[model samples]
Target: LFQKESHIPLPPKKDYDKVRAAIEDALDKDDYDDGSYGPVLVRLAWHASGSYDKASNTGGSNGATMRFDPERKFGANAGLEVARDLLEPIKKKFDWITYADLWTLAGAVAIEAMGGPTIPWRPGRSDKLENEGCPPDGRLPDGDKGAPHLRDIFYRMGFNDQEIVALSGAHALGRCHADRSGWINPWTNAPTTFSNAYFTELRDNKWTKKKWSGPPQYEDPTGTLMMLPTDMVLIWDKKFKPYVMKYAQDEESFFKDFAAAFSRLLELGVPFDEPGKPAPA
Candidate 1:
């Protein structure tokens, strides 16, 4: 997709490639979270695109509205401000790239750099003024709810049962921080890369209710991993269970579907001059 402003001129292809690489270079090294910034970067992209409203088409990554309040202040968006701040320098260097496109590209690139699918992406999203395009609360999924809730949330954004399963595969990469989402620990042994381990673990493990003071969640027998009630419901419910098994057994299948769903996600509400092209290599 072409940048909205013809006069401003899109960053030359080589320069755009440099900006993508620079996002990889800037990962935070602190131990509080994973040593890599991939997870949060993915979250930044997901949160940006996740806010799209199919009915009104108000949200999605087009406006980069999450930088402002309500969205920045929302409960589901906790810990995301860091992701926004992390991308600031990249924005400065390639001042032409909009936050909507930058955050989403950061996410897609982080997934690839951290050993995940190469999400097809492009730059077309334009920046919105402060508080100009913030989506209302409750667009993102909640960890405490079940399958019906997942359906309601994702379906609102035009995802099918299959795409919803594919997108949740992202959990394989990130951990829940006590200070942030109130849930603690990564879902997989390797929390730095994208894999179908989340699907396999959910399908294979004997998960019992986590005996803790925090919100209801599940822990595996070995105590090396955890799953949200929301995570487990995928296996428990018949409608969502088959896809769980499929992703667990086939990594390529997961990657392909995830790319399509996520790419479609980034484009929601975006009025691209050209509709269906993948990101530049």
Candidate 2:
């Protein structure tokens, strides 16, 4: 008898583009926050992948483990279910794609659709069968902490100070829901657009403690915008401050660095067969 060989064939890049299109179509609705689910989608992708530990290689985007109990219930991940649920119909429509791939792809598409830089993404991640794959609690960053906390959380994921600042630039896109993170307000007036406004606002504005009942957070003089302790520390720290200023001065630089850093962020711990091509717009 002849030996038999069998394997599952991967979807071609064009099929992945169709998935991308479905994600794009699902992004905008008048009823949603800021008229787009883009910000939450980006948050979903970041939180899903941010659990990586370079030393152990245990967490990150590979397993789509956030669907599990402990990880889903993590305080840092509050309100992200909105993002995950938004992607579910797309997941059902394209049943062949893994939840891991779909979540990350929605992030890249959200960024591009919201006037941000193009993030290179690919599809190869697989789902975990059980919650055993969940990373320990506290793997994600704490908004209430400062620079030291930022460094410890990000450094564990193999990122340096520069990359930390670059990744933090993502704050330009979303607002904090009081019910979710115990913080409230957006970092910029144009919260829906992805620009260097985060860095610019952080650089140019004078942030004072918001006189409110909420957790400790900073707000601009007008009390219209806000910043977390983690965000405020980027300007106060010597090492992180320079990049913050750099991105603030040059939109092109911010876009370039953000694209590279954010792209690498979503790919953490994912095993791919080969190099990935540029993601479709």
Highest TM-score, which number?
2
Whole-model Cα lDDT of every candidate shown, in order: 0.87, 0.90
Error of 2 at 278 (Å): 8.0
Clashing pairs in 1: none
lDDT of 1 by residue, 1-281 (tens): 35556668555553668888899888757764778888999988998899887987788888888888878999999999888888998888887778888899999888888888788887777888994758889999999998889999898899999999899999998899888889987899899878899999998889998888998889988877999988998898898899999999999999999988988888898988766764443
Error of 2 at 27 (Å): 0.9
Model 1: residue 181 alpha-carbon error in angstroms: 1.2
**How would you encode candidate 2's per-residue C-alpha lDDT over 1-281 as one tens digit per residue?**
23333455556443887898999999888887778899999999999999999899879988899999888999999999999998999888888889998999899999999999999787778898884669999999888888889999999999999999999999999899989998988898887899999999999999999888889999998888999999999999999999999999998998999999898989888777665764332
CA displacement after TM-score superposition, residue 83 of candidate 2 (Å): 0.5
C-alpha TM-scores of all predictions: 0.92, 0.93
Q: Can you tell me which runs of candidate 2 are displaced by over 4 Å?
A: 1-14, 275-281
Any runs in candidate 1 off by more than 4 Å, and if so which?
1-14, 28-32, 278-281
lDDT of 1: 0.87
